[model samples]
Target: MIGDAWLWVAVEWSPPSYGLPFTDQEFDTPTTVALVVAAVVKAAFLWLILRAPAPGPMDRRTKALRRLLYLTVAYDLVLWYPLALLLDTVVAAFDLALWTSLNVLFLLVIRWRSRALRATAGTMFALELAGMADALLDELDLPELGSNDAVGFVLALGGAAAIVLTVVGQRRDGRWSRGTLVAGWAFVGSFALMISVVALADMLFSGGLVEGIALDALGLVPAVWLAATARELPTDIGPADRPPARRRELRVAMAAVALLPIVALVHPEQSAHHSFTGASPPCYDQPHFGDLKPSERDAAFLCQARIRYSGVPPIFPDTLPDQAVLAYGRALCRAKDREEEREILTRAGSERPDSGMDPWDLVYVCPEVVGATRPELLRSAEEQKAANDAYIAEANARCRDPWPRTKGVAQATANYFLFVDGDPGYLVQDPGDKAAEQAAGLAMDRVYDDDTLIGVGGSAVLVGHVEDVSDLCLTVKAFRAAPPRRVAGWDYVNEVPIVSRSGQLTVPEMDGGDVGAGAPMPNLAIRGKGRYRLRVYVRADDSGEQHLVVVFPGASRKRLQLKP
Candidate 1:
């Protein structure tokens, strides 16, 4: 029942923006349910602590563990009440600090209980502390001392060794009481169970529901068992003070319990998020961007793009004249000055000697002047109507609808799609290595060459870790041939590049691969015999008084052969 309830809590949690969807508190049903569950867990913890047998004369470890229990209950109470209810930066910091302290205290108790368990707990605890330091560095914008993955690897190896030692030692020595054994095992087992459930659940769901519920259950069950079972052997007169018989069953149970920590330590990498260090590669100067999850990349992209295009001094010093012209044209269109918009745009088109600006881009800049002077721009009134409707449909789909836009860009473009998060500030392309180039070209060609090929692949650039929002823009581009029309379409429409607005691309979490999780793009379509070229551009817009920024690498005109 507890486990299932935990799953519900996970589903209903108001996790941070990076974790999952549905972060708004307006949908308070799940939070309310979680609160109820938390209350139950807290009550159980308190009951166990209060009802447990008091420590006898010289059970120092027992006394220490009892004190830890009281502290834990206090911490949980704080988490349950006003602290949990009020979410703020300070609250988050307090929560993190309390959580770390609790874990550390628990480890100290384990170390105090038995010399055999000490080494195991000590090693893991030390690693945990280091991981915490790394996390702290990331949070404070300090250089990372080491990678979390490395720390996890070491912890896993050491934990496996510890487990073997503990089980072997238990099998040989039987001095521990059944109650003590239960408490000891429960100490490790509960934490392991929570960790395992959370890791497995992450695989199945993006939301934090599964993990949250399990955490509550984990926090209570073992503590209850410990309190109920805690009974020190009486140390009184003569023979009465002798220890209880060591049971074979209890030893076996201890052995089984020893296995639990191994499970917890198995995949330490996943725990990296809980750790202090940012998981981003050491290449990027700033840890801020590295901390952001792929789900929240859209917002990061928009924030960065706006800065780059603002023509702010020292950031983007040289604004392209063409981009400036396009920005002006867009402003004129917005102000309902269609005549001036057309004249300026038309004159700009005629006079600007091979301006990098494309006709399709100009249309977006001045959509109101669609029919006045550019009759050739649309095939007919019906085509114009379709285009206008498509424009509206695209806007509505991007603004209001969820994934898989109204007319899937992937489908409309015959799988060729391009979604860019404008641009941050810099540019660097793949300096073609023969082996890598051949591989990328072959991958692209294979899809275009074979009729049996339904899947497509393209080149990806994972430029290590980005520090600030300004460090990078999420760019995803795919090109498709314009649908054949009787009237000449806008020149750039032949290779229409669609840009993804903020909050559009929701790729899976990056695994710290070489490509570093580039923005996702649609598949490249191969329908006709003509060879294709890929290009990228930077453009600016004036959308609702915000300076628009679009900086992207142009695709190489190096044509990929259609034939195999």
Candidate 2:
């Protein structure tokens, strides 16, 4: 029954995942099988023992053996299980070491009760420890016989030996001598001390001080119980007096010893490396990437390849300035003999002294290159009104709205300039009272959901308003002349899209502004050299017809014509 219980507990506590190379699902079946087999074997052994004749009345030897078995079982249940399994997360390494130590101690106790059982139990324990060491060494990639591993092994073996000596003396002398008593106490003390040291070392290296201390305190209970119980067994009994119970007691001890090797054989090994040389398999014999099949290799490569960007900017920063977008644009213009496009690029490049022509020609500009401005100052009332009037006239010209009333109407315009061939630059305009501002705020909030989206920018124009509109006309012409769908490679380049929030649009606070020549809004470029998509959310004070026009270099103008 005790063996059955221990087996069940071991299966529950460690499961197969504890040290095996099986997936999670595999553990369930194997664990159930192992536990059932162990229980059946243990039950059979117990039945046989009960049927056997009592060797004799229980003698001192028999009593001592019984006490040792009880102690070992109690220690394993109370100390080893909780510390190793229950408190694994906080002090996994420490718990493992302590559990290993307890196993050694338990084997030694069994050996003392029945020397004939030693060959089996000792060999099993040794092999199990060897396997554990092998796994640890492989996992940690440590040097052989490192200080920690050597000390731990010595402590465990020494503790086991001490228990054996104490048990042997009691059997021979009928009572424990003062020296034996002291040694027994010292063994318990040393065990506790070693556990404390291991816990503390784990705490210092890893960060679980509170858990280490708690587990150490819990470990003391079993140590005390074992020492006190083992000390009570009588030291002597005559052969005739012990005959009745001796057979059963010895049989139980032998069964325990035999079970060890069986358990060891069935125990799946962990893929850990031990610090000891003899504990591990040779490196060349271990599995490696090359051992994977062709299918696996193909799958791995495909998984990596899907995320590669063909023309998109590298996500990470580069030491050399990013110039892909500007260079691509310039090369395209030069190939097409577009002198005006080349001159525009050259002028923007020359303005920045340090970078010379490099900044303007780069695929994208660093956000730092664009000077900071108050978000409010990006547009003014007069500029906004004139732009709105021109937009309305243009819209009216396109679609005849006989009864147009533009009051309380939201308006906005967004323009995107791309130097390569892909998605053309986009623009959005809201023209209804203060609705545009609300729309922009909502859009900004959405873009910044993940803390990644930055600001937006583009030229704001009032169509069909100015009598002498050479400057405004030139700005539009210049925008129309640039190549389409091409990007400027600059620092901090990213692709961002404006997504609208749900529900009716609400107008936010708006300080009406007019955008005109020499206004900061026209020149207020953020990260000056990169292509951008501008979104304008606005409401016209009075409505006739509102036009949100998006002009791209060398592409037809996209006009969002609306009337309110």
Candidate 3:
């Protein structure tokens, strides 16, 4: 329950911008190393502290150390763990709080009861066993393990019973040996059950037993600690004569010990965002236009193309302009037919604008010739009508479906299909609609913790200037090269070219141009028959040394080449 609550809080409060830059493998190394080191240090400290001779009557240093350890352990289990749980839950809204809280609570109970520490440890071991069972079930994608509510109720009742038994047994005989023994055996039995479940799951599912083993190891820690400390009990002692100073020292030591493992678990290279400039390989300093060797020029062109088209700085060693130009040139060279050459040349010509070229003329000539071959690429007026009909059908079906089961499913399914199918144009045919949908989706997705469906909408505002619509076409084409996989969920859209320009390519304010009241032209285009193409129609007054800016959400921009 706490885990669920924490997950809710995390999902609601966390920003969408924060994400780990490295892959799981890349991030695991430092975290694993840190955890290992911390664990070793903690174990060493615990051993040394336990091995130290009992203070005869009293020793101040021992008392101080014990107090520190107690405080540290208390802080970690009671304060730090809870806080971390809260933070994590708030950030992702995943149900991890229950696991974190239970772990800490078990540790605390063990610390409070020296004689029954073994029992407490054993109970924790049992919980770990249950945790392993749960993990295995999840890995296997098994049916819900009972219901969450049922599981929570059972756990609560079990905890209450254990507490009652401990309190009653302790008060009656000043020792809970029988109860402890029973609890220990029960816990061990639970562990055995979990092992069986894991083994079965491994056979059925093929893998995931390793996770169960890791969980089991985690569960055994308290039991090991209890066993190591069990031999030193003074039998006739009562609560009145218990050493407060010694208790404090033990707590402090345990805390210090715990800190070691946590430190080791965190990855060192976990960055929220990656800077592409740092990752890309070296490239030429200048625009090597027709002077360099073909290969070198190709490399430089790729770098420029990436820079100009991506709007983001280079993530790889190539430039955007060079890449676009080389690609266009290659297409031209390989053309076997007159029609193919025209199409390829049209695509190549659309990339860079001549210094004195009229923006409107360029937009008119390029998109018409280049985009003509791929009429199907453009979402037709009729197709838009069809999409509207499909969306309505889906929405109506959603209402008819059972509650919760299909409430969010239709929208999610549509978004997923859109992403998987690599067609942002389906979501919106016009630039303004595209921008609006993208913004709205982003906002809504954050609120619902539905990153999977909401991430497909493309940004509307261009980040950099383009010489002509051809540049814009190329930029958009590159952006559409690879759509995100719906199942995997969208993290980043790959190969989106950002277009940067030497001069400004500003759009007129709403009142200043024909774009304000009238419907905007759809930016959708398709590649066909070895050539790039799109259809372009423009209002008369909308003319200039136009710059088409393509911006990816988190990437840099680059320029596309207009001609070979």
Candidate 4:
């Protein structure tokens, strides 16, 4: 199965479509047949053991060994059934490593007295450790192991040596006939062959599917061979025949060997390398957020693709960056499969609505942490939906007429509104905010005393009123702090248009009655909900400069009757 999959991946699965050809053909019949065969073989192996003369009053040591043997087989079954018949994840990639570990552990236990067997365990353990070392290097962003094939080649040579030693050492022991020794060594040799085949297959067909039926059928070959050989071993053992002194060494060696492969194959690095940073379908060249790092963007793409395609669940690093998680949520929201998209997105977060409110507008009002806003604390999708529904319901109950979004920030009943303008480049130009607090306080005080003032806030420039206009917007553009020569000490950009409620456009005069030409903002009609314009009017005097605040009308979609 591994061989076929590897072949398919290399020849058939190419870039932009690195997956097996889905035939819609199920492997039910073949899988069932393989399972039935394995069951019969297992039952017979158990029958042979139970039917044997109880080792002539089995010793405690013998009983323990028998228990361990049973556990080995049981564990194999536990992992194999689901994997062979129903597994669908990338976990299948580690099947070879897991099987080899289990087999080596079993062999080490049963054949502890043989020096040759111990040597084989050591070699395999070392080879597995090298694989793990390579994985570790990759995770650390270090140079990768120069050649995976080099490790495989070394392991194959070691396996051959192990087989030869197994035969020679078993023969010297004289525990059984030459036939038995050769048969056991043949099993060892077959295991070695299996490892080589699996490795080569992976190299050939990296990410394609194999014939499930053939795969399952082939899996049974080792189990049947192992069982058949085990059933034939003699039931009796003498006290001297068991090597107690060597058991501890064998156990330690095998335990270490078994654990290395699990660590290498199941580590987080194994799952994260297959992300779609460059791909178009899974990830676009220009992502939703282009500023993200390659790793962050790739994580986002893979996170969404796994959910969309029902691919293997990716193992993420424990300490994923905050931006990366946000990116993943955004990508997940773009999935075409609405059901899965919602399921994954809601689990992460609701995709942040593109409010289009410029960050420059809010920086003056919010001098601290203006760019640090994150949606990590948003409520679950269901709760958010409920909140939205409740707000809409309450709004409907209060107002008889439907609120048209085109009305911008205007309310149905309110006649007066409050607005304030501050230094457009205050965040960038005067990040120290030497005069921001006083200016904002003065403007806020004006609104607090007035009844017509619905809401008052400061913005850098007028962004035309529109649907999804948020109060805060963050731009990466650099702010130039260069001040006008006439203004002195502080930077002043330009004059801004002041639109009357009756739709008249005029520039507000500065402190010297100088009508400075202002830059054109988004021209928006002064409907009740239209965008409000605020311009900082700088007045030069002997005591430096002061900005005259003019109040325009600005309101948010949400309304509250503070005075009425």
lDDT of 3 by residue, 36-150 (tens): 4444544543453344323233234324433443444344334455556453324222223333333333343332445465345335334433433444334332332424767
Q: Write the per-residue lDDT of candidate 1 for residues 1-564, one digit (tens) a residue.
A: 344344444443432443334543333456457656766666655665566454446354446555554555555534455665553444545544553453443332232335446445545544544444444445433345455667655644444444333333332334334554555566556656655665576575446444454465566655454344333322220221213463344334443343343233333332222211112122222113224443333333222212322223211112223234435445444544445545554444433222223333334334346435665453444565566556444532332111122232241211111123522222111223234444334444443342322112233111111122322223333224322222221111111121221212112212322122222333332222222233222212221111111112233433222222
Error of 2 at 519 (Å): 31
Error of 3 at 312 (Å): 11
Q: TM-scores for all candidates?
A: 0.31, 0.24, 0.23, 0.37
Best by TM-score: 4
Of 3 and 4, the candidate ranking higher by TM-score: 4
Off by over 4 Å in 1: 1-46, 52-55, 58-65, 77-81, 85-120, 143-177, 202-215, 225-564
Q: Cα RMSD for candidate 3?
A: 26.7
Q: For residues 1-564, could you state the per-residue lDDT of candidate 4 as single tens digits?
A: 454344333332222133434434332444335445544544554453343323245445444444544444544545554455543322333444444554454454344465555566566555544554454455544444425677656645654555455455445444445544655565565667567567677565434334332343344434433333343333433344346797677567666665664455443532433333222243223233223433444344344433222332322222343345444444443444556555654555333222211232222222233335623222344655566556444532432211232232211211011122432211111112344345344434544343333123332122121112111111111011211223333233222322233342222212221122112122132343233434233323342223322224443322222212
Which scores higher on lDDT, 1 or 3?
Answer: 1
Q: How many backbone clashes does candidate 4 have?
A: 10
Clashes of each: 17, 76, 73, 10
Highest lDDT: which candidate?
4
Candidate 2 lDDT score relative to the true structure: 0.35
State model 1's lDDT.
0.37
